[model samples]
Target: MILKRFFQRSQSPARSCYEAIVAAARHPRLYADWGVPDTLDGRFDMITLHTYLVLERLKGEEPEFRQAVVDEFFRDMDRSLREMGVGDLSVGKKVRKMAESFYGRIAAYDAALAAPGDGLAAALARNVFPDEEGGPDIAGVRRLAEFVLTQRARLAAQPVRAIAGGDVRFEEPGP
Candidate 1:
């Protein structure tokens, strides 16, 4: 399967996986905890993870750290694709596309965050819904904030996967 090729070429999936998990967990927590509403569909955990991965890449960490984060991100994305019944090559391609899109969004978000004023909120709103206005709609902002918190929680929960893998596992709040 694709995992075989991915592992063979990449090698040491564990280290890479661990780094990705850490990177994904590094976003600002207040966003996720105070921002997202109780009622939304889809898991924000993945989005938060993607954000941290992008930030880490931007920071220009060592190659090993970068590769590990990328590998882990792809692995988790592939797992999500598989669960959705996507085929191997398709999953690989889609994961790449998703990563690119995610990176682009992260860059945009970082730029916004660096700027003065409440630009980050506007940038996030635009990123989340480009078709709409620049500022975050009520729900979109909430989701973004929630994602930040969730990412922090995920990282905190999973300090070490082999020892605490259960911590990173996504759990939806009760309706």
Candidate 2:
């Protein structure tokens, strides 16, 4: 009993943060008010942005905890793929694709954030806006880029204890 109590591991906090990020990404303002297309690709882009922000904020933490969060993120992705009917045989390939996409976006978002004068906006446009239709929604992309930066700042300001305890909160979107 003492061992169990001493070594208790609570996964809820991390999972809750994951859930919160997803819900925030799924907010309707992103789709309706901000004009992020309410399509699969659009949704994926939003989630990726949120995930990237979280991962960035997690920098400098204990490696194990950070990796635990990443593992959970991929576990969620795998489950989502299965639920969405990605075949068992193809799931690996799809996950590989997802990981590649995640890594690429991380690099891209890092560069965009570090860049000046609408760099992040341009990156957002390139990723979230479909090429087959209208050109990037520059205005909406601007808002989302700002949103990403704002969230990144807020997350950095949070204490690792609070974050690990699932006490994270995202700033509300602007009008």
Candidate 3:
């Protein structure tokens, strides 16, 4: 009871937003037949993409809340690593690497979104299909990029209270 109260009291407003992002990213349709590899890196990339969207949505809000969400994200990453049997020391290093990778992704994705033409697809192909044998699936990259743009617009339209309360929802990879 004491522990529950302690945790409940400390919960961030962005907790639900994070949970919503993870839930959508983990949707089986993203992997089962969508061409996303069912491997660890694939999963990480998807999660990072979704999380980055949420962070971008938070950009116009209080800086502290955005930082809180980011901090909470790393905490969740640390917990996930431990749950997956990573040793404590290695977990820190791995999470550090993940953070660096995510920041890089953020820059690439932001640039792609800002640039003209098929830059978003190109960025997705490079990041999400980095290990594909013949090369990235152009169709799949295009579809994923479409979804990102759609979802970003939807996220931006959501009331801040709804997002903060974790009631966010996303359309699938199509209209």
lDDT of each: 0.50, 0.81, 0.82
8-118, model 1: which lDDT tens digit per residue? Answer: 854464444455444444334423543332221123333533535343432543455445555665676678789989998798788778778667766766676567776
Name the weakest run of 10 consecutive residues (lDDT summed) in model 2.
61-70
Per-model TM-score, in order, reads 0.51, 0.87, 0.89
**Residue pairs in steric clash, candidate 1?**
16-68, 31-145, 32-145, 32-146, 32-149, 35-142, 36-142
2 versus 3: better TM-score goes to: 3
TM for candidate 1 is: 0.51
The lowest-lDDT stretch of 10 consecutive residues in candidate 3 is 166-175
Q: Which lDDT value does model 3 have at 49?
A: 90
- Which candidate's TM-score is highest? 3
Clashes of each: 7, 0, 0
Q: Sort by TM-score, best first: what order?
A: 3, 2, 1
